[model samples]
Target chain A: MKPIQVALIGLGTVGCGVYQTLHIHKQRLEIQLGAPVELTTVVIENPDKHMKIAEKTTISTDISDILYNPEIDVVFEAINGKEPAFTYLKQCIQAGKHVVTANKEMFAAHGRELKELAQKNEVQIGYDATTAGGIPIIQTISQLFRANQIQQVQAILNGTSNYILTQMRDHQLPFSTALKQAQKWGYAEADPTNDIEGYDAFYKLMILSDLIFDRQPDQKNIRHSGITGITDEAIEKAQQDGKRIKHIASIKYDETGNLTAEIEPIAVPKEHPLYAVEGVDNAIHLKADIVGDITLTGPGAGAFPTASAMVEDLCLILSKQSAPIPVS
Target chain B: MKPIQVALIGLGTVGCGVYQTLHIHKQRLEIQLGAPVELTTVVIENPDKHMKIAEKTTISTDISDILYNPEIDVVFEAINGKEPAFTYLKQCIQAGKHVVTANKEMFAAHGRELKELAQKNEVQIGYDATTAGGIPIIQTISQLFRANQIQQVQAILNGTSNYILTQMRDHQLPFSTALKQAQKWGYAEADPTNDIEGYDAFYKLMILSDLIFDRQPDQKNIRHSGITGITDEAIEKAQQDGKRIKHIASIKYDETGNLTAEIEPIAVPKEHPLYAVEGVDNAIHLKADIVGDITLTGPGAGAFPTASAMVEDLCLILSKQSAPIPVS
Candidate 1:
């Protein structure tokens, strides 16, 4: 079997994590995929910062190095934002390379266009890390839940906001104090605008909405509110009522087929599955027609968890390259 | 595209559910699979018991009805126990037919042999409904968790047993009273010995052990116990300490590659994920090296939930018969 040549387009937290994971689990992945997956190129803005990786593989500052290389079969985009990453991925797909990415913001905005392009180009695109990390909700919905009609999905998507809310409820601390604590623990970014203002959760919700409902709602119609405005008194009252104020990203379809989606805080009762989900854990409670109610809870974010989703996607794509392996 | 011909054996609870679900969701499944799936035959013990289903397809008491029909691409076995099911499935595989089964007892005893036979004959076998009902743990472990090293698994595998335990703790009922209530609710069979004696959970656990550990433990070496021994006093004592005595089937691996497995009533603390799993709801908490701790919870039994898994497997098999579909 010929090796599947791969390239990396970033060296940030998630990028480094993916590199380390693929390096550590190379042998096992080869065995599962029935082919060798070799990382041939790494594209980064600053090659000096990753000298150790540079020694093992070619580190280039130009995306064209991978985009023009016909030998590269797959490209992983781990950079944040929607600009150059989108353009680079588009070129890669046009160049007949399968692409896997963790850019949630870019995926939320331009996923439909990219999917259509990939379909036309006859290549596959994977974005499992765009939604809840390590939960496999995308594959679960696309494959396992294909036989059921998914009614609703209530999810705790953003780990930074969830961490802040948990801190406030557990310690009775103010919002600012909780934010500072989350930042210190490396859960929140330095900017923290996207996470604390609910935009992060909104993007993930859009990704899931597109997959589950088969269409995306207009951006202006989605009602979203961040946890920054949540008061300490509100948390205390919910606690007194034996409830927890959780930042929930929810989407539901009514009997008439109208879709309703929102990102806001809800006081969840003790009986609800999302109530027990604390700290940085993310949980998705999905209601469907055939399977009834199902909830998947796991790490919402982090180096290994996010990379784990990406690697799983890569393995699935590679496994399809050969004869189908029965997984019964 | 040619329609995939399917056969169902046994019109019991799960078999009937699969038939109805496939009937109702035929159009939708056809759209997803990119091919029509036709129920061409059904093998039953007594056709008189299922006249309605018999009216729709060929109903025969003879196993060779499907085993000899080369047009029958897939066979589903939903009967209980190991004798006829194992023999029929082995013959189906040998005849170059893919097989799906929900016989946990049969799977536990002869899964390895059946898997080997299927592999030798180049046929796929699906047994997702054999364990955890609609949770899709088998697919999750085989596909999504392929990138990680799974450390341990703690699960509530039997819905009848868990339902009885929940009634015992919540209503302070004795074991026998709870067992009667479970029977009345259709959660337990008339002969509740298999469920109450923990053999049902034990069988499911062995199936999971085989998949995760790549081997099965000797039945004599497994430490097994039942919920029948638990008294009202034990439930009260655990409740006083903010704990619930859950029937937990657990498997773990040490650093030296040794395996420890047992099925017993455990007093789980409030912090444990299984502590909140009540009634017929089943939950599996898996700890893996890459993705960290993950939990999947849903209805452990019932016609539709179990049928949901079987149909999902059917769709997957049918989908694979054509070009590979990218699920990302």
Candidate 2:
């Protein structure tokens, strides 16, 4: 088989991760996929910084270099946020190139639209790395739970918020101090508002809802809150009540046509699955009609973990002899 | 799209479960797959026993009925043991029919051979229900962990032994009495030797090893033990040491090619993930080079849970517009 040529849209944490991971696991992936996945082009702002790993690969500042590259069959859109990443991905799909991305914010806002566009353009778009990283919850929701009606989805999604909440509850520290500690440990960004303000978890819930429930609730209409409002006193009170406060994002399917979706801090008993999940770990518990409650927990964020998901997507796309099961 | 035709080879617990789950989730699966999954035939010991659920479907005691039927595209081999179940499955595969099985003992012994035979016959074989049922751990190891070198695999594979151990440690019941309680709750068989003697866990560990570490250590060479030797006194002494005694099945890959595989009673600390898993629940922790330690917990065995896995295989095989990534 011909080598499966690939391109990277960013040279940041996740982009470098995808490149490094493909290097580290190149042999094993080739054996598993029966074809080589090659990094042929990388689009980055600072090409000089990545010259060491970008040897033998083309480095370009313009995104069109990747979109127009005749050999580049798949593109890894690791650019953060919506502006250029979304536009670049749209152009890549429109150009009939497969895309694998880790952009949750863009996916949450335009998942349905982009999915329709990918179908219309006769290409495939995979966002397994967009949600909780390395957990493979997206494939589980799409493939494993096919025969069951997923009645409820409860998860601890945002690792930064989880780390902060754990610090506050474990050491009795104030919210600001815990936030600083998380940032110091590199678990949170300098701004950290999106994660701490519940937007990150909300976006993940929207993507999960699209897969499991086949409906995405409007962002403005959903009741959303964050862990920043969780006071030390409230944490202590919950502890006194034999409960642990966790930043939980939940979606419940109602038989009466009321699909409720919320991302907020909730007090959970010790027996709850989310209670055992702590620090920068994420857990998703699905209350399916057949399998009861199944929980999967792992590192939700990290360069290698997220890149592991991306490489899996690339292999799945290349190894597939025909088109995949349509997600939309 | 034409309806996907399926047949069942047993009306036992898991067989009836596949039938009932297919009935309950029929419409949802049809919508999910964009085609109906019709139950074409049911081969059972007592055809009259399942008449209420087998309405409009062919019911027979002869296994050839399903294999010879050209309309049946897939077969569910839920029959236990190696004698007729294994023989019938081989015949089905020889007949060029896709097979999804829940028989672990057969799989552990002849999984590679059957997989080769399936590929030779141009059919697919899925055994997600064979190992750690309801957890969806098999797919996670095969698909999600494709990019990582899996280092270690530790799991609680035998739920009956865990249940008996919990009974012995928690209720202070002796081994025999705890075994009786497990039997009373339908958690254990009347003989109960396969689970209690560690053969069940040993088989599951073999299957997991085949997926994760890419090594199938011989059953005879691997160290194997059971929970029958675990006494209440030992459990108490371990509790005094702040540890919980669990029947653990593990595979460790060393740098010097010292691939250690064992199924025995071991003591786990409180912080260990397996320490929190109790009852009939099973947990698997995979320590990979990239993702570090990831754990999945869920029901290890049940009628519906195993059936849920089998139906998932059915849907995946039929729902795919092309063949799936072959599992070796």
Candidate 3:
């Protein structure tokens, strides 16, 4: 069988992680795909920084190097932002390359357009790593739960925020202390506003909402609040009530099909699945009409977990087992 | 597109559920598959008992009715036991019909033979409902976690056993009383020995073991114990220690590839995911080399949850997205 030529479009944390995962699991992937998955090229902003990591793969600073290459059957885009990543991915899709991405923010905003473009171009786009990392929630929702009407989703999606909240609850620390601890542990970025302000979870929530409901809510109508305002008193009160304060992202449809979505802190009782999802782990609890209730809990962030999700997508694409974009 | 002609080879609890699910979701399925999924025929042991439920579909007492019908593309086997279920499924696969089964007992004993037969005949076999109902564990392990080396799987596999244990702990009842309550609620069969003796969980565990490890352990080497030995004192002791007595089906591989599997009552602590899994809800916690720890929890039994899994298999087959038998 011909090898599946693959390219990497970034060399950041998740990008490097994907590179290492592909390298380590190359033979295993070959056996799974029944075709070798070769990482033929790597695109970095600065080729100088990724020399050792790039290894034998051709390194280029230009996205066009991969975008224009007919041999590159798949591109894994690990860039973080909207502007160039979106443009590069769009061009890659148009070039007939199947794309797998970890850009949650960009996907949340422009996933519909990208999916439509991919469909028109007769290529596949995978964003499993864009949501709850390693959870396989996207594939589960799209494939396994395709026939069921998913009525509600409650999740702890952002690892940084979840880690911070776990620290606060476990050690009885203040929010600032927990944030600092999370930062030191590499769970939080320098400017943690996106996570602490609930925007990170909100973006992921939007991605899931789009996949499950096939529509995004009006931005202004969606309610969201961060964990920045979760006071020490509130945490103490929750503890006293035998509950854990968690940053929960939730979406539910009413009896009349009206959608309500929000990202905020909730005092979760012990009976709830999300209450036990501690530390940096993520959990998604889905309530569907046929299947009743199902919950998936796993590592929500980090390099290997994200790479695991991306590789699973690659496997699906390679084996021609990937589900169509759940449009309904 | 021509409708995918399908057959159901049983009209028991699960068979009726599959019929109802396929009937109710026919249009939704058509929209998803881009083709109609028509239940053209059903083969039941007693047509007299199922005429009302059979509705518009053809019902037959003979298995050859479905096996010989070239128009039938997929066959869902919901029969219990090994004799006819295994023989009928073998002939169906020989007839070039894709087969999906909910028979854990038969699958545990002869799944490998059936999968090999399906592969040789160039057809697909889906057994998602053979194990945990509606949790999607089989698909998750086969597809998402294919690359990762699953080091261990700890699961609550039997709903009847779990339901009885929950009642015993919650109501402080003896094992026999709990067993009676489970039967009264239809969670356990009249001959509840299979469930209470851990054989049900053992069979399901073996199925998972085969899927994940590609080999089943020697039946004689397996260690299995029932929840029948649990006394009121044991439940009280567990409660005092802030633990729950859960029937855990566990399989693990050593570094040297030695496999150890067992089904027994375990005193699960508060931190364990299985501790939170209450009543008939089943949970599987997987430890893999790459993704670390992941847990899937959902309704493990009942008509809808079991049918939900079978229908998902149907959807996969209809869309040509069903995963190949994981043979690594």
Clash pairs for candidate 3: none
Q: Write candidate 1's Cα lDDT for A177-228 as tens digits.
A: 9999999999999899999999999999999988888787666667899998
lDDT of 3 by residue, B91-185 (tens): 99999888999999999999999999987887888999998998888888876777788889999999998898889888888888888888898
Residue A71 shift from truth in candidate 1, angstroms? 1.5
Which stretches of model 1 miss by more than 4 angstroms? A325-328, B54-56, B325-328
Off by over 4 Å in 2: A46-51, A218-221, A322-328, B46-53, B169-172, B321-328
Ranking by TM-score: 1, 3, 2
Over A1-328, each residue of candidate 2 has an lDDT whose tens digit, in order, gives 8887888888788887888888888888788777787999888877777636646788888888987777788899887887788888889888888899999999988888888897787777789889998787886776567777888999999999999998999999999999999999999999999999999999999999988777886565578999999999999999999899999999986577778898999999977888878899998988988877788888999998888788878766665644344221
DockQ of every model listed? 0.55, 0.47, 0.47
TM-score of each: 0.97, 0.94, 0.96
Q: Each model's C-alpha lDDT?
A: 0.88, 0.85, 0.87
Model 3 alpha-carbon drift over 4 Å, by segment: A321-328, B321-328
lDDT of 3 by residue, A1-328 (tens): 8888899989888998899899898899888877888898898888778737545588998888897778898999998889789999999998888899999999999999999998888788889999999888998888688788898999999989888888887788998999998989899999999999999999999999999999977676578999999978899999999998999999988677778798889998988878888889999999998879999999998899999889888887766633322211
Q: Mark the 10 consecutive residues where model 3 chain A has the least summed lDDT.
A: A319-328
DockQ of 3: 0.47
Model 3: CAPRI class: acceptable
Q: Considering only chain A, what is the TM-score of each predicted structure?
A: 0.96, 0.94, 0.96
